[model samples]
Structure formats: C-alpha cells, structure tokens
Target: MVRAPCCEKMGLKKGPWTPEEDKILISHIQKYGHSNWRALPKQAGLLRCGKSCRLRWINYLRPDIKRGNFTEEEEKTIIKLHEMLGNRWSAIAAKLPGRTDNEIKNVWHTHLKKKIKQKQDSNNQQLYVTVPKCDDLSVIDLSESDNSIIPALPGLIGSPGHSPMSPQPSSSDLSTVTETSGATAETDNIKVEKMDSSDMFFPLLDQDLWSEAELAENSSMELASDSMVAAGFYSNFPRIDDDNDMDFWYNLFVKAGDIEELL
Candidate 1:
C-alpha cells in the first residue's frame, strides 16, 4: 500500500521557517497539544505542511532541543551507537537526550565520518614499520684478506698492555711451523749419520720406519722362495706357505704392542 503525501491541498508553504511562523506554531502547540499533525497546521493558522511542521518542531522548535555544537561526550556516544545501530539514525537518537535523528544523521555525514577515517589512517600508519632501502645499506668485508691477526683487547689474557702471554697462532701459522720443523729434522738426521755411534744418541723410530722395514724384509723372503722353488729345493711345499707366513707376522704384531719395541 502507498502512503499519501503530507499535504494534498493546493497551497502549503515549504522551505526555511520564518520567526513569525515559529512563534505561531510554538504558541498554538503550547495552547492546544498537537494530537493530529495533519490538522495541526490548519488549526495553528500556519501555511506549512503537516510533515514540515512536525520536522520543524522536533528538530528546532522543541523546548528541550539542544541547538549548539555537539559535546565531546555526545559525539562519542553517537560514534558508539552508530557502530551498533549502523544507519538507524532514529534508534541512535533515542539514546542521546535532546538530539533528533535528522541532527544526528547530519553530524555523522558532515563531521564524524571524516574524524573516524582520519583516526583509522593514523592507526594504520602506526602499524606499519619503515624498512631501509637496499641502496641505503653498506657492505662490510670480514674476510681473512682484510686483517690476518685480530688484535686482543686491553683487559683480555694475551693483550699487549696486560700479560706477557702471546696471541694463539692461526691454522696457516701452525702448518708453516710443522713444515719448517720437519725440514730441520731431516737436516739433523743427516748430521747424526756422520757422527760416531758412541757419541750419538738413540734415533727416534716412527711407525712408518717399522712398516717400510717389514715390507722390504717380506719382499726379500718372497724373492728367496721364488729362487728356491725354481731350484726345486722344496718340491712338497704348498703354495699356501706365503699366506701362512703373512698371518703369522700379522698375529705377532697384534700380540706385541709395537714393531719398534720387538726390533
């Protein structure tokens, strides 16, 4: 069903209300209460529609109507109510005293919407972290080529100003020292060979010397056995004799701790 227009009559005033019209409407409503808004305009002798009169009274002419700028508390209440009630301006106005739905709706569109947007923008800015661009950064070289020796601190164990203790050698320094020591050992062995047995100290025997001597002795024995076999000295000897000899030497080395000590 379609509702009829507020004023179907030929002439009814519209637009901004005049002071004379306001005074008449106020006086009439004060004398006789507006029970029927459609008949109120005719009874009050005002040239306005029923809907126009109702809006004017509710939005402006009411005795309890607040006319000035909205307070901070009222603005906050409107914002909270708007979040809960959404675009229901009448429902939101019910919670605020002396405020009409039209006033609240106007304030929301004109002021509150912009304020909420600005607040949201400020919050979004706070959430983002500013990262420095790659071009702004500098590269640092911490490779061995840059500095071979890292100087000790003043309070540390091997620092120059503190103890007489030296800095620990690097891997390259250790390897160089080992090579120089090995060369000096070879030179000392040559010198020891020229010295007499009575004047010389016992030579330091390593596991490599024992292995080389054992290999040479085994090669000589194999050559002798091949020669004996060719001469037919042991015709009944099995081919497994060489294997038995190898097992015997391996077991002897296992039982005896070192070949150097046995020698």
Candidate 2:
C-alpha cells in the first residue's frame, strides 16, 4: 500500500505560522487534545495542513518547551550523547529536558563541531627536538658548558675520553689504547675463535640479506633469518642478555675505573 503525502491537499497554507494561528493551535490542543495530528487542523478550522499545525504546537507553542540559550551543562551533555548516539538528534533531545532536536542539531553545526575539531588538532600535533649539527667531530667540545653533550648511557660520564670535563681523544690516541690494552686483545681472540668454530658471525646488516620488496612479500622468512643472526650475537654475552644484568656489569667497570675489563 502507498502512503499518502502529509501536505498533498491543495489550498493548504504553508510557511511561517502567524501569532493568531499559534494561539488557535495551542487552544485547540488544550481543549480537544492532539489524539490525531493528520486530522487536527481540519477539525480545528485552520487553513494549514495537519503536519504544519502539529509542528507549530510541538516545536514552538508547547507549554513545557524551554527557550533562551542552552546552559554549559546542557552543552556538555549534548557532546557526550553525540559521541555515543552519533547524529540521532531525536534520541539526544530526549535526554535534555525541554530541548528540541532541531535546536540541538543547529548548535552542533554552528558551535560545537569547531570546538571538537580544534581539540583534536591540538592533540594530534607532534613535538620535535632540534639537535644542533656539527661538521667537524674532532673540533667538537664536551666541556661543562651550556651546550655540553649529555651522555645517553649511564656509565659514559666516567668512561675514558668521554667525561664532561675531559677533551675527546684523537684518532692516534684511540689506536694507541687499542694496541696497549691486553683485555681488548683477549676479547678479539674470543670473537675470532667463535667465528672459526661455528661460522656464526656473518654480517646481519648485509645489503643482500633482504630487500624492502622481499621483506614485504615474505615477512615470516625474513624475521626467522633476523632472529638467527640476533641469537648468534646474544650467545657471545650470556650474562648480559637482559637490561638489569648489562647495567650491573657496566656500572662495575665504571666504578673500578678499568675500561679494558669492560671490553
């Protein structure tokens, strides 16, 4: 069955309702009640459609309809309800006493939407730390000045040539320290022995290991290969596998002032 249009009848009045029309609609509803909105206007002797008369009474001339600006609490309630209910204006209006769905919808478009957008933009903004660039690493100073280098590792402050008050060692000084340190030679011998025995010291950062396209195509195979390389490196230092154990050993070397022992 086809539904008849509400305003299909010809010669029916439309547009803004007059003060007299509002009075008649209010009085008619108060006396006879609006049991049937589709037949209300015809019975009340108004020159408007039943839909028009119904809107006039419910949206405008209802006795309990609240007027004037919405309060701060009401606006907050509308925001919360909108987040949960979305654009169901009628459902949102039911929570706010005497507030119409049309009024709440108008306020959302004109005012609330811009406020929400601004808050989201503020939250999404990224914070960047600016690091000063230096072309000459040899000329860089590490003194206790305003622009002094802050150590990232815990034991770097007490380490040789990396102290805040000491000047950084030159390339010649680094080579001399490497040649004289007995513990450094022992550590190197241990690494060489392991490489000869198991052949586990293959370069994990080789360019041919896995391309970006290959990684995207087969992530599981690439991950397994990467894990095997990582296991080989971790196997060399069984005691320093976790952060706490690593920190303990590093701090011990720093306190003893033996950089060679830390090698």
Give the alpha-carbon lDDT of every model.
0.51, 0.50
How many collisions between residues are there in candidate 1?
A: 0
Over the stretch 20-45, how does candidate 2's per-residue lDDT look in tens digits? 98888888999999999888888888
lDDT of 1 by residue, 135-245 (tens): 332222212222211111111211222211123233332211111123342222110011122321223334343343444456644433322222222332222224444
RMSD of 1: 39.9
Each model's backbone clash number: 0, 0
How much is 41 displaced in model 1, in angstroms?
A: 0.5
Which run of 10 residues does model 2 get worst, by summed lDDT? Answer: 188-197
Listed in order, each prediction's TM-score against the native is 0.48, 0.48
Candidate 2: regions farther than 4 A off: 1-3, 126-263
